[model samples]
Target: MSADTSAEWFDPDTTTFGDRLAGARELAGMTQEELAKRLGVKEKTMDDWENDVRDPRAMRLSMLAGLLNVSLLWLLTGEGDGPGDPGVATSYVRGGIQLMEEIREISVQMKLNAERLVRVEQELNELLRADDAGAA
Candidate 1:
């Protein structure tokens, strides 16, 4: 948690540079292979960076921050603008689920309404035919 009681997505006290790197990469919706390919590094190299077995060069670090859409300072120290708190992600997922459920309900209602409309049309056609036959 920070000074204001908001839980940070990444706590510098407990997490290492590798942890931050991996977290940011995942949030960016990237696999290690994709990121490594974009960064012109081997998959093993990216794994090394994420495993704390090696660090990136300064230029590579800058590219990484830009590619991940996180501030370089945050990537290094977990203090500046990075991914927001984990709560935000949870809320987003919850909202998505609610929307999906609503859509499903609406779809069921529409199907029922369509069936009723078909029945009404058939009844109307039958009445018209009976009237025509009586006139004839």
Candidate 2:
């Protein structure tokens, strides 16, 4: 993952509330079990929240934001101050970029293949039409 100057890389607008929560938690160097223990919630509950299956109540959300060193608004809406820098390594960033590029390439290839399949199907239909006409 090379350094990307695009706001898409870190823009809150592109992320969901759960994404913000998980990112903040990771930046705080806390695991789901650890955070759950601190919050007096079950690990499954934490997982559900992080996975966007459920949301925390107002008070618990506030506490979670504070514990993760993020603003409640940011955690909820990604509008305010977010988590502090987690000191992500350049190599990791580069790797992520590479993986994203690879995925994009694969997507393009898949689209092309789909298009080719459609064209083949159309040709086969045309051939069948011609064969029927000849038989008639």
Candidate 3:
């Protein structure tokens, strides 16, 4: 069986460099942290590039294209060759990628919730101490 190629993910003309970079990275089944580690940069640096807050330098851009198995021109201008055949296993891989992304998002949310809980606890403790002093 062959994978469907009839549906293109995005129009090349309309896609931005950051969009291409992110899509290629996801298709390559790499997390941002993993890609950053391989490129000898911080994960926040990769996030910045993917979010369009910053651009990768020429050397790093070339390396990203190579690592993601895409053409340099495609990564930059969304022209030239793109990713290769995803193969029959692509569906399973894509599912895994989605799950991983969801997990990462949830993990971030959990951390935020924990921080909020800590602050609330601190506030309650302060209020109880004030009440005790008033009663004394």
Q: Candidate 1 — which residues are off by over 4 angstroms?
A: 1-9, 85-136
lDDT of 2 by residue, 5-33 (tens): 32233566687777777777766667899
Give a tens-digit lDDT track for model 3, residues 27-69. 7777899888867689999999988999997667766776776
Give the C-alpha lDDT of model 3. Answer: 0.72
Residue 36 in model 2: lDDT: 88
Residue 84 C-alpha lDDT in model 3: 56
Stretches of candidate 3 off by over 4 Å are 1-8, 85-136
Model 2 misplaced regions, further than 4 Å: 1-9, 88-136
| Model 3, residue 85: C-alpha shift (Å) | 4.5
Regarding lDDT, does 2 or 3 come out ahead?
3
Q: Choose the strongest candidate by lDDT.
A: 1
**Per-residue CA lDDT of candidate 1, range 23-126, in tens?**
77766667899989877689999999999999997767776776776777988887887755543421112234334544565576689999999999999999
RMSD of each: 17.8, 16.4, 10.4
Q: Which sequence of candidate numbers ranks them by TM-score, best first?
A: 3, 2, 1
Give lDDT per model, in order.
Answer: 0.74, 0.70, 0.72
For candidate 1, what's the RMSD?
17.8
